[model samples]
Target: MKVRTDAKRDEILEIARGVFLELGYERASMAEISTRVGGSKATLYGYFPSKDALFLAIVNRLAEQYVLPATERLEQSLDEDPRVALQRFGEQFLTFISDAEAVAAYRVVVSEAAHSDIGESFYESGPKRTVESVARYLEGAMDRKHLRRADPAIAAQHLLALLAHGEPWHQYFLRKAPSPTRAQIKRIVERALDVFLNGYKS
Candidate 1:
């Protein structure tokens, strides 16, 4: 099957993402995706050279869908007061975890992480970047006297660990019970900031 150059790579990737979510990393076969996308395994290979390549493409697609939009939301609303910005940040970050793709990716990564470096790489690219972004924001806020002085990176990791509730988000990815509510996320962020500021006030 000849795929036109004009064929929407993103459209294919989105379909592929749903496939990954449903079947996970090892179980998700290329033939399954080929059928869904109206292409043969050969055509799929033309677009993605191997299973790892397909997974990587899907990971990049999910990052665009799940990460970039959330980042934009935070940046666009970042001009508000520090407290409100923090609240918005919590809301936006929570939004990512609530996503099916994000959840599925975490499950896939955690289940396979002990066996595959790919999973580790994915986490580094996605989760690690998020933590660092939050740290950078906190650090900048401190520089401007908007937030109290401290290790912003520590504060950043703290915010996430609280959101995770003592479990690395892998617990949620594993279908753990008692998924949090919006109010819970908001409350935790408020309390985290309170504790963080109390420790940092000079």
Candidate 2:
């Protein structure tokens, strides 16, 4: 017989996220998680066999919750004017970093990647997917003569690097500065596009 969960999976995931964020994939203890969730480790184990299983669930959840939608938005905007397309993309990318919880999750991933294999998979599924999707868009625009000719992957990386030096990375890693005003984001994305397309446009 199929068994329904006696305890809510969402509730466990919610508490588990705090535990993983605070303690990270390596240092977090099941006993501590069980305590936080008001369950014995044995009960927690019934739901999640090991710390790694719980951590992996969080990683997979993050990719599903954040990354896929961001990429889908970009893919759907391929027909927009190149500048408008880029601007929309920039805004979506920026939103991920500016939100406090998303920023926190990213920082946690950065820290954990130094220690675990799961981190590598998470990077592939999320940030790496984002970079690839951006590159494919650049490639498509280049093919359509809407943008410049260049290696899409390299072009995409360059754009991301440019974006990073500005508000998102700064605000993500540095301090609780004010979110970048829309004017600031538009200006940078515009200037970056100008520089890039100037060199690549054929």
Candidate 3:
């Protein structure tokens, strides 16, 4: 048996991302991914047991590469003005979720949700993680008297919900509009931060 290397796994994931993007989850095939990766189907299966697993891995990878790190920065910057830090986080989170690749992955998850566990898996791996991260940050802020005492998890949910308010999120999910522009996102973040701080300020 051949030993699996991180390099080989990453290479396979890279090819798989492009293939998945080009053909989409329902249509993309392991054989095609293996061909692009210069590997056998067995090798592909060795790395990822099934197509769903591969797709989930790709989604999680993208989240880790983009979302997690950005949130980590938010946590690290907690000493900054709470409003400023939260505005930055809100903008970052909205921007990350509105990316084309992220939206595509979200569509794939929604499409497969009824038939498979992929949707639940995505929630656990992606959005849940982001929520938990923000919750932690909020908890810390509460402890420091940056915000009034409240349920951090609920506070985190409120923050995200406010950030996602209005037509940009709704219209995009409905396929009626494109991702929000930087200026639009900035306005949204500013408005959300105003409401959030007013409600939570210690």
Per-candidate clashes come to 0, 2, 0
lDDT of 1 by residue, 1-202 (tens): 4655635566667788888877777778889988998877877778887776677667766676666666556555445676777676666666567566666666666777787676767777777887777777777777777767888888878767665554335545566545557776677667765765565544
Q: Please report, in order, the local distance difference test score of every candidate based on alpha carbons.
A: 0.69, 0.73, 0.87
Note each model's CA RMSD in angstroms: 3.2, 3.3, 1.4
- Cα deviation of 110, candidate 3, in Å: 1.0
Count of clashes in candidate 1: 0
Pairs that clash in candidate 1: none
Query: Which of candidates 1 and 2 reaches a greater TM-score?
Result: 1
| Residue lDDT tens for model 2, 1-202 | 3343845666778899998778765677899989998867777888888776677677667666765676677767768887777777776666555666666666666776777765786677666887898898888888888876788999888877766554357755668776677777777677776776676676
Clashing pairs in 3: none
Best by lDDT: 3
- C-alpha lDDT (0 to 100) for residue 182 of candidate 1: 73
lDDT of 3 by residue, 1-202 (tens): 7999999999999999999999998789999999888879999999999999999999999988888987898888778888888877778778888888888888899999999999999999988888899999999999999999999999988888887654366766658467889998889888878888899999
10 residues in a row with least lDDT, candidate 1? 163-172
